[model samples]
Target: MSRRAEHDVRDLVERARAGEARAVARLISLVEDASPLLREVMAALAPHTGNAQVVGITGSPGVGKSTSTNALVTQLRRAGKRVGVLAVDPSSPFSGGALLGDRVRMQDHALDAGVYIRSMASRGHLGGLAWSTPQALRVLDAAGCDVILVETVGVGQSEVEIAGLADTTMVLLAPGMGDGIQAAKAGILEIGDLYVVNKADRDGADQVRRDLRSMLALATGRDGAWKPPIIKTVAQTGEGVDEVVDKLAEHHAWLASSGELERRRTRRARGEIEAIAVTALREKWGDVHGRSELDTLAAAVAAGDADPYGAADELLAAFTD
Candidate 1:
């Protein structure tokens, strides 16, 4: 908490609140890098968060996630809403940077001041999302984005991580992507708050819709719960995009009415807190590893003198103490 550093963070927070894109981008970069001053940055931004509506879009690769996200941004902007987009891309092995392909697809919004888009690298983290997504989301929320869209890396079955981060999760599907039964097998059916069939102009689109409906009917939901709606869209031409937005609005209203919005946000916060704590513990364990205490414990376990559970407890005690 040096005076100079504190002053810099405060200035950045003020500039971000005034809607300066550079300040917002800088703040998100700090989150991504796990900066030493992260706590200060988060504290300064806390008061302005929890206002934006977050929607997550995920599916298998080639499901048109970026196109749909761009289309959704267009619709939201037309309704006079400020939009933020976080497009998570696979990390480059050498550069450790986002591929930036998704941002290229969203070039339509490049000049729109009402829209801010950032491409983040997954950095080898699983679950199809970058580790810093939640923190980046807080920055966008505090920056007065009316809606934020999170586009996952779409790494097949494990992509359900977005469900934990977004207020509304839209699982996108295309006609030839092994049909809707595969969507169920991919584990998206359980997490989606809304299902979107993109590229509806293609053949077998009706069959895709039918398969989705049939699959949804078989899957049970909470008692008196919301039934996820299925919408069709040709994202390239923006046809049927408006209906998708309308369904999103309807779902948002239902979330408020059922008190589910608060519940979801509460769960999201819980996950974020747990993640930070776990990361801290891992760092502490790394220090212990450097001391060779873990190696000593492994030797004891090898001799059958100390069981695994007890050895684990001893290692954890090294840090907790």
Candidate 2:
């Protein structure tokens, strides 16, 4: 990068660390766009990250994930905490852009200086998150957000990937959603740090809670493992959200006292590193002229002229060369 571009990135980082929302947004845009300055941006922001609590909210469609996130933000801000929200929406195939539905739902905080809300498109990426989510998260973390809420696309079963990225993974369910059985089928029971039964004003809410408790009882855990708490909430009315925030704090405390915070962060970092490395290798492989080595090897394997392992070895050898 030229000196002017380098200076601009430094200025952006400074503004972001000083709680400038536009600077934070620009940095995240760089991440989403895969800008050439991404490396410089990340290097500048690295020292300011790792402070925000990343809470992931995920569940099936119509489970009130967005409403619950908004309620949580209200409660957090009431306590004087600076909050950031990244709502990952399904990408529009025609436009390849976020539908911005989550942002619309969260307009109550639009004027709040203590809050920054961004909508990211999943862009056909699976696992309920955009591929660039972790890097976007670093931008928010470096921007002095006390808490970051990552509300994922309501992709049901595949949404469990949020557990790997969040410091606390909250799985939201509602009455009449078949959530009790669906939770088990989706494997969310294994990943949730907090289970919230939203829309509790409706009938069958207690039964859903009872069924969840019974199911959780059957799952085995190591001694002293933090038991996931199931909280009931009517997120639309902001009822029971305070208790949810309290449980989040307790979970955060346990994570610190048990040294699990460091372990989880380390694992998160390892995954980020692996993802970056794999993406780089794929880009390198795609750089070959006309027919790449991978394509040549794939053709040979398909023709039964070479075994898969041998072809893979040849590809790796070509890379090393």
Candidate 3:
């Protein structure tokens, strides 16, 4: 939160590769802040970031996300890559504690020096992903992880936002899941840089794959690009896990050759900036206008003195100064 503290965090971050869990924890906290100090720390760490292959995985609840993540971690570890996972879960609206403890599902990675798993709760954020996810990923990226897997909380816009944040977005859908198809309607179908039909051992696996392939076949991308590959995975048995990872690497290679990596990176950076800016604006406005101001605005609306849109416009006017 302060200048000296951020510097200390940088030092600790460097040591995190040496198995300094304390340093890793500290770096995570520092980046989670909205202070200028945080921005500076992130900037200083920027040169060291972007080395990790950021893979975002999202899908329906019954899609076996935890199982898939575990299998993916195993495959990555076999390749001798240091891996970090940010498991995003939703917090209770009342208690503000995560309802699903990610650690419970991911205990195998606990003592793995090559594997780092951190669970984050949404804390009632509407976006499905936690507010601090970007900086959190950056921290892991700078910590010398070769591959970072971000698992989004299975929800609507949050999952889409998670896809936007990844270098390769893998949507995990189960077989015969009509609900999964419905979830795809929220632009998840389009945002996927890659797709995974997990739980493929189940009935109707081929049908789901056919549906996805057909859907992808019908769509024309920005440049009439090749259809993103759909990999079937039975994570519970480690079936087709390596194929999924291979497809991810394939996408990255394609990104490098097609000159799309730079453009995608630029777009993702802008999205992160915008998300931070909106977050800052909300925090600042709340601080500037306190409860009294909000109450006044509410009363004005009730009295028909100020319309809701005009009241929001009033706040935007304040942000200008």
By TM-score, the best candidate is 2
Q: How do all the candidates rank in terms of TM-score, highest first? A: 2, 1, 3
- Looking at candidate 3, the ten consecutive residues that score lowest on lDDT are 122-131
Mark the 10 consecutive residues where model 1 has the least summed lDDT: 122-131
Ranking by lDDT: 2, 1, 3
In model 1, which residue pairs have backbone atoms overlapping below 3 Å?
none
- Evaluated at residue 137, the lDDT of candidate 3 is 83
Backbone N/Cα/C clashes per model? 0, 0, 0
Q: What is the lDDT of residue 40 in candidate 3?
A: 63
- Supply the TM-score for candidate 1: 0.91
lDDT of 2 by residue, 1-321 (tens): 899999999999999999998898898778766777988988988898888999988887898988899899999999898999988654343454555554576889989989999877655332224247888899999999989998875453246566788999998888898756676887777788889999999998999899989988888753258999999999999999999999988898888889888888898888777777777777677555555888888889999999999987887787888
For every candidate in turn, the CA RMSD to the true structure comes to 2.7, 2.4, 3.0
